[model samples]
Target: MNTVLRLATAACLAVSGYLHAQLYVGGYRVIPLIGPSFLVQASAAFAVAVLVALGGPFLLRLAAAALAAGALAGFVLSRTTGLFGFSEQGFQPAPEALLSVLAEAAVLVLVAVTLYRVRRGTRTVRA
Candidate 1:
């Protein structure tokens, strides 16, 4: 179960990271301010995915939680309140956006479960 969860989390992270990174080439031209932010997010997310894939590390778990939460928050804020004055197309169920959100949410869930199990001393997986 731990292995499965870890892999699933990593997969979601990969997808989310890719989506975030894609903004560099896709939307960054329209919003130059977001380019740097997308680069940082993509790099951090990919690094976290690699760490989680490697195995249990206390720091990795913390990073995973932080990155997932941050990604989700950024996504929601960008879609609703419009991050940096650039709002998304307005909650219209865009396929790409939906996929990214779902992946981020999954990562959040899996990472939280992993953290809980680790805290309770019941986790069999390293991460």
Candidate 2:
């Protein structure tokens, strides 16, 4: 179960990384701070995905969770208030935005389940 959760979470992160990288190359590269941020996000997501896929410890899961949550927050801000002085209407750039959101959300859910499993494993019954 733990292995499955790790792989699923890793896959989610990888999908998000791929989407962001594609967006960066597809012209977001000219968007100043936002451009660099996307690149960093892609890199981090890929790295964490690799670690998680390799059965890394809980710390790696924590990092993956953080990365996914951060991406989702950025997505929301970019659409709502603004992110790096940039705002966009409903999931612009076709399906990538929507896909990325779904992938990040999945990562969060998978990580949450992983957390529960780990916590449950560490619990001890009364004598």
Candidate 3:
């Protein structure tokens, strides 16, 4: 169960990371702060995903969840108030924007479920 959850979460993160990397190389690598942020996000996401997949550690799950949440937050900010003075209207990046958002969301849910199951199993059944 844990392995399944971890793999799922890692898959999600990998998807998100790929999208970010594609975006960065597609032309976003010149948006000042936004460009650099994208690169960092991509790298970190990949690294975390590998770690989580290799070992379903609680800390790794937490890190993965945080990464996904951060990506989602960045997406919202970029579409809403704006991220690093950059704002996109109505998912301007086409499928990448939407797909990445979905992937990140899934990572969050998967991580939460994984963590919940781990904690639940550790409790003593007060029968």
Candidate 4:
């Protein structure tokens, strides 16, 4: 279970890092409250990195779960916002919104599954 969690955490970080790096190139601004100049791609990457760096038995599970949820939301918003015909900025979804949504959905599933397993293990321990 720990191995799976570590793998999932690493995967999420990698995915987020890739996405963030793209945003940096694209010049997309980060969502407000998180950071002004912070890009979505960078934020996701940072979160994943933090989790992996802070891997402790006590908080690793919670951090992993939060990162998974954050990734899921980021993916969803990135996809759905463009469905309404938003202007194409440097970081905007290209071609179509559906593609972004689909991509995000896939990422979400991968992260979610890993988080779910971690959660289940925690629950089993508690019980």
Q: Model 2, residue 73: what's the lDDT?
A: 94
TM-score, predicted candidate 1 vs. hidden true structure: 0.81
Q: How do the residues 48-99 of candidate 1 rate in per-residue lDDT, one tens digit apiece?
A: 8888887857577567667778877877888778888866765433666778
Worst 10 residues of 2 by lDDT: 118-127
Q: Considering TM-score, which of the candidate structures 1 and 4 is the better prediction for this target?
A: 1
Using TM-score as the measure, the top candidate is 2
Give lDDT tens digits, candidate 3, residues 1-127. Answer: 7788889999999999999999999999999999989999999999999988898467988998899999889888988999989999877799999899999999999988977787777684542
Candidate 2 backbone overlaps, count: 0
Model 4 off-target regions past 4 Å?
A: 29-44, 78-127
Sorted by lDDT, highest first, which candidate order results?
A: 2, 3, 1, 4
TM-scores of the candidates in the order shown: 0.81, 0.95, 0.94, 0.48
Q: How far is 127's C-alpha from truth in model 1 (Å)?
A: 23
Q: For model 4, how does the per-residue alpha-carbon lDDT over 28-98 read when each residue is reduced to its tens digit?
A: 44434322222654565566556665664635545545554554565555456742242234434553233
Q: Given candidate 1, what's the lDDT at residue 105?
A: 84
**RMSD, each candidate, Å?**
3.8, 1.2, 1.3, 5.7
Best of the two (2, 4) by TM-score: 2
Residue lDDT tens for model 2, 1-127: 7788889999999999999999999999999899999999999999999999998888998898899899899999999999989989898888999999999999999989988876777784422
